[model samples]
Target: MAREGARPAYDPAGHDTALRATLQELRTGRWMSMRRLLTETTAWWQWTRRTQVLATAAAGTDVVRTWLEEEPHSVPATVMHARVCVERALRAHREGHPHTLDLWHEAWRASHTATRAAPPDPVPWVCLMALARLDRERQWAEHRVAPPGPMLPPGPWGLLAEADKRDPYNREAHHRMLQFLYEHGTSGRLAEAAGYAHWAADTAPPGSALHLLPLYVRVERYRRSGGRDAALDLHWVAEDATREAQRALYAWFEQTFTAERSLLDLNHVAHALWGALQFTDATRLFEALGPYWTPQPWAYRTPDQGDTAQAVEIFLQARARCRPA
Candidate 1:
């Protein structure tokens, strides 16, 4: 049987009819086979030659589009295609290759335009990062302007901070609120983050990372001064967040570490989780650090007090000490 979205396999007997129907379909934007329409995997060098030719010939036209649709997950293939197109365009621009930049720019605009027209539902954060960088580069190449940072949604981190001062320990509320804060914070929603933080602090853990996060160093002074309530409050805040937020951090951490390679090398996540008293997730991460340990490195700031390495160590230590249940 013929494939689902393909034209009937060409047959000499029906050549005239097929030709007439295909031509008519083309005029209406109906492709013979969307899957076979643009196969970029024929061979890398050969593919580039064709892409370059198509781009050069179709400069400033919607020749290679289909990718901007946000219906599908942000697959690596889409990212790679965008990168290849951008690289070729930039190279052409730099080398003064005839029509190279124009073709590349055309392709870039087509894809990005498509992205904007129907921005991915989840907004394809990573791929959008790539697009953002590409736009910044292209702009600098022509207009010399840096792209602005991503726009965020509102959150309540500030309010929560104030509330935490009035009542320094409230793990359950903190966990729930922090969950909403972090989730919404991704969209640059500060008001939402602040509201969640306030709610979280309203009834947060007794002593956890949530409380110690903003006061890692200063709180240490309180801990050393026999301020048991303050110290324990800090402890509960960290631990509670870790345990509750384990899945989110776990997904990210597991993406990086493995059983054979304890995150002791980086330690930040582990430490943060440990500070939150999230020994269970930490232990699981330590034990499953096998092939899951991605050789690719990742680094990011956390809570301002400790780095990734500290986070890892703190968690590893916790994992080591926890009695198996």
Candidate 2:
């Protein structure tokens, strides 16, 4: 409920009030609030989400390191230390940093230690999977595991399974796996990734966030294309596209509580529904989103891939299109 005019300013905290506050404190070099927040979070999904966000904030700071220094045996601190390390590695990979190999090894070691320290938690395994992207050459045998089906290429399936054993249909785990596929794909179409996405959504529980997997893959596929082709405009409203949007709508949005929904997932579904021209169905998602919005999905609606200003404008235009009856 930021008061900055009509449009809700983008909130990076993404609907988690506690996470927002804790991120602020961590930015100022305080780890106490983060400790308390994660301590009280018992759900796997929320724990993963909070850790991901907190790790991003802690990546450039010593907050997680400091916390670990004070509480060497703390499982939460260990998990967070792993999370920050993985975040750093992922960021380094994206930037093509020269020391990516060193960071990747450091993150891998930290993540393995976290897996040992917190066996029941999925975040550590997720950490391991997240860094699988840094292994573009698939040097490790874990990165070369055979896929369960014919569609998937060799990947760290064992790491994905370990995380899944802890939390079935974990959103981030699948996302991390998808990231690996995208980075390691041999073709421009990401056929393996598309097949993997559909396979995931096929097995997901109705209420789980994994329902949004195919939607993300669609966005990724769309982005991987030149993204500006007018003919490709039909990509969103095609039979498969609309069906995917509706499947996510019914499977995820309708089955979950408003409070528990991932903000980015909400944005994805709303963007999909709107793009598919299902304005009436999209209306509810827009209302559920309130003022907050993520920029990428909407940015894809524009010709430019990462155009925030145009993205916001398109988001507002779409919101306007799907208002109350």
Candidate 3:
């Protein structure tokens, strides 16, 4: 059964299809394929990480744990196990399920094990950062921490530093660190997050995915403040704060635009532009995306609404506005 004007749960685009096949390979114990898929290229690790997270969220933690048990020293499997644990913890928190702290600790232990197994792999360290964020949130909620400081202890920053040592340009590592700092930084200010985003963008090499950092911060800001209408506030758009965000977004789009690699970023950029009333620019992204919609930026826009419905509505609206007949 299908709802009217609703997008499917998962759009079968080329990348999505590839990810599904890769997950199948992993589930089938195709270690060689998994290694080649994860390690043979740059930025491919992001897809691996994303795939594991999605698979774990959709399936369950036991599948990934079984994969880990099958390959004790497998870096990919271990990292994925850690990621699955972290995702489960986050999901439990969102759903108000019990034993979230226990899940967080499990994620921490798994990430630590993965880090030990593959000292040079940044993926495990990225998982540590995620665990650290969860732990920090737990501490804040429990202790009611005072202002001017995060409840984070020393370990997470060390993990991020090690990740940087392993891969100075690790996009996921940087993004995770940015999220950690943005939420827990002493000032708790969007300006601080923007500062980190701009610095990362400036330091990154040309055509680097780090250019989307500011857009990430902007999306976070929008989510924290409110949904679509709040994001579309004239004052927020006209303020000096968004000037750099817009510049960074357009720069990323101009320099490193691709429908293939970072479709998630494309979705974010489209959402940002649409909120800013840049219908034409948003339309280009919608065209590039075609029917393959990532339910993130749209989902965030309307938290109470179904993700597929929200995504479909936004996509159709952008298409109509951008391609008026």
Candidate 3: regions farther than 4 A off: 1-16, 24-36, 39-61, 137-155, 186-189, 228-232, 235-250, 257-260, 300-308
Best candidate per TM-score, number? Answer: 2
Instruction: Report model 2's TM-score to 2 decimal places.
Output: 0.96
* CA-lDDT, candidates in order: 0.35, 0.88, 0.62
RMSD of each: 19.1, 1.8, 5.5
- Angstrom error of the Cα, residue 70, model 1: value is 26
- Comparison by lDDT, 1 against 3, better one: 3
Worst 10 residues of 3 by lDDT: 140-149
Give the 10-residue window scoring lowest on summed lDDT in candidate 1.
Answer: 291-300
- What C-alpha lDDT does candidate 2 achieve relative to the native structure? 0.88
Q: lDDT at 196 for candidate 2?
A: 89
Models 1 onward score TM values of: 0.29, 0.96, 0.76
Candidate 2 vs candidate 3, lDDT winner: 2
- Judge candidate 3 at residue 97 and give its lDDT: 84
What is the C-alpha lDDT profile of model 2 across 249-301, one tens digit per residue? 99989999876887789889999998899999998898788778888787776
At residue 81, give the lDDT of candidate 1.
42
**Candidate 3 lDDT tens digits, 1-325:** 1223435344433355545566666566454555555554456445544544444643453656676677777777777777777788767866878898788788878778878887777777777666665655536332233222343322245665677788776777777767666656666557766776777777777556687787778767766666657535564355543554465456666666453346677777766666666667666666656556677766666755456677667665655665542
Count of clashes in candidate 2: 0
Output the number of the lDDT-best candidate.
Answer: 2
Q: Give the TM-score of candidate 1.
A: 0.29
